[model samples]
Target: MSADDTDFLAQRFEAHRGHLRAVAHRMLGSAAEAEDAVQEAWFRVSRSDTDRVDNLGGWLTTVVGRVCLDMLRSRKSRAEEPLDSTPHGAPPSPAHAAPADPEQDALLADSVGAALLVVLDTLTPAERLAFVLHDLFAVPYEEVAAVVDRTPAAARQLASRARRRVRGADVPEDDRVRRRRHREIVDAFLAAARNGDFEGLLDVLDPDVVVRSEAGVTTGAAAVARGASAFGSAALTARPTPVSRHALVDGAVGVAVLVDGRVERALRFAFVRDRIAVIDIVTDPERVARLDIAPV
Candidate 1:
């Protein structure tokens, strides 16, 4: 392709970049990996016969979906067990971590709270790709089938099965009472964490829960329970006065630990079936300072 031809194609690709990123992120559950997937799509798009592609957007979306599906399959093959076997709850280097996005954070909290990603992890790669494309992105079933290399009928079935599972595990986002219940459950969890009650935590936590903190990521109910026990030691004094407040951290139900009006730690909890599935604690100074924490 000529220089100007390549430039024009690049500009056209840029138009779909944000959308492609969103699609890939939903499929892969990591923004970084999504970028990589999108980049790969761009490479394929650039080299492919553009004339033969009647619909550029649809073609690129399919390519990205196929790339993500392959990646997911490779990851699954390498794992000792299933995807839920280990949540990516490991401690992060805040200094090196990408700048926080409150909108994305809130969305993630919602996704995790509803166990959307956890449930998505359970789905077969074809089913996941089919569902995410057709259901989430409004891609037609025919296109979805093309991406997954399945018949249109099989694609519809894949999406149907995925939809049923997601609906079962999904939280009621539309219900005001359900929202209130989420806050109350999280508040109780915070109290339990403060009181050094391991069993209490276990009561609220899912069997395969994960907790991420400055110390490290704690996976499994037993380890998370032990960490809950350790948290109470510091809560004796550091959390004395008002205790912790249940607030909306970045527009999601989260607990904020304050020391004299300053947020010391932000606890973002994801509830699955009204039980805690993931606990992400952010103690980084810069990120904590950016939180929009308000009482429930």
Candidate 2:
């Protein structure tokens, strides 16, 4: 291939760079490692003959996935500290080293992703790849099978098994029930916000609900509904990150708002009779600084 051909290929790869990084991030659970995997994928792509490849984006995604799979396997072989060597929501010990990246710390400390990543850490490399690709990325089982060296049917099964694990059946019987309930409320709130379902928001929220943030606190269902609506509007336009993660907020069931791979805010909930009564918004800077590991 000519120099022009290599330059053109590099440009094409750049178009898929963000997505490739996201894939690796979710797979490796470290932004730094994810970027390294993406860089490796670019090198591999540059060397390979893509004359027969139809979808350049899809091809690059598969390459990145394969690269990340290898990294995860290598980490496993090294028996490195589990990503959450600390408890899922535990604060770091002062005697230990602090995180290398504060924003990345927010990803785990303030987002549902922290607990989810802990669960993903338990899966085999092939299972993680199969699930992250097919389930998260919507890659076909046939394509995923190629990455994991399994049949399409087997790859689908791998994802299913991984999915069950991700959902936490192995958790203690008591903990599982509590997490399930938290998941329900958080899911409902997110759905309501995304769909502009005011009634739905009111349904789960107590009539005397209070939403407290650094900005100020809004009390009562009507006031709370209006505040949520404004937030929903901004989310729909500004970032479109209506996704919330179930996390242990200050030791209770809470949800965190994830935007562009960072935790924008976390809400610690106080429930009364199965209805959301108090929502303490764990805003960044303070939340990131403290871990608000403080119990409610």
Candidate 3:
């Protein structure tokens, strides 16, 4: 390509940089690695003649997917085990350490939750690529097949396997253990609430924890602690004692309040650094009925 042509290609690549970066980050779970993959894609694309290329965006996405797949495979070969096997609260191994970057942090919080990232890390490179490209980004399985060097039907199966893992089906042993730990924390919180232990509630809650309910929003540990203690007292005095059971509310550790063996209320929790950072109380009968409550 001539200088002018090169410049034009650069501009086009810049136009798709944001989307490409998002794809790579979701695939590799590292901002730095994602940028490297995009750069590699540009190098490969720039050298090739694209005069016949009809869909520039689609072409670019496939090239980036290819680059990310190679990077993920490289990482996998060097690592001893899947990331999900890492014990909770343990420092990440070097192969898995993503630099602390604000942009990557924002990307994680916006695109995929931290928990989902952990699950994704357990997927094989081809599986991750198939799922991230076809399932998440809406790339056709045909394109995904070309990128992963698999038949279209085979590519679909890869994404299907990945989808089940990401959805908490066929989970790894350690991942199940992590979920158990999260349940333990929820159990502690519920126990504290039932006993009217103010300090106990605060122990598991983040200092700036926020609770949202049908009634209203409450912020801060002290405020939520007070509400929890009050709820506990009310539960004790109210007829047909309310029973709190640890259950999976929307695939996360949560508490379901049962009155006379029927779920009447649910508390969905979002954890930050193993502390309860947010609690969504679902009391609306319709909403509560819609929740996918399952035994943990």
Question: Which one is best on lDDT?
Answer: 3
By the lDDT metric, which is better: model 2 or model 3? 3
Compared with the true structure, what per-residue lDDT tens digits does model 1 show for residues 221-292?
Answer: 888778777866473225545357777664456888778877788877766667777777788888678555
Better of 1 and 2 by lDDT: 1
**Local error of candidate 2 at 22, Å?**
0.5
- Candidate 2 lDDT over residue span 160-263, tens digit each: 78876776435655445655765687678767876778898898898988877777878998877766766774632235644556675534567666678566
Which pairs clash (backbone N, Cα, C closer than 3 Å) in model 1?
none
What range of 10 consecutive residues in model 2 has the weakest lDDT sum?
87-96
lDDT, model 3, position 278: 78
- TM-score, structure 2 vs. true: 0.52
For candidate 3, write residues 1-296 as lDDT tens digits: 68788778777777887778788888988766666677677777777788899999999999999988887887856863232323344322222333445854573554455567788888999998998887556587899999999999999889878776877645567656667777888888878988999999999998989888777889999998998898884632224777777876754568887888889888788676568877888888897896667765
Query: lDDT, candidate 1, residue 3?
Result: 59
Best by TM-score: 2
Q: Ten residues in a row with the worst lDDT in model 3? A: 90-99
Report clash pairs, candidate 3: none
Which lDDT values do the candidates have, in the order given? 0.72, 0.69, 0.76
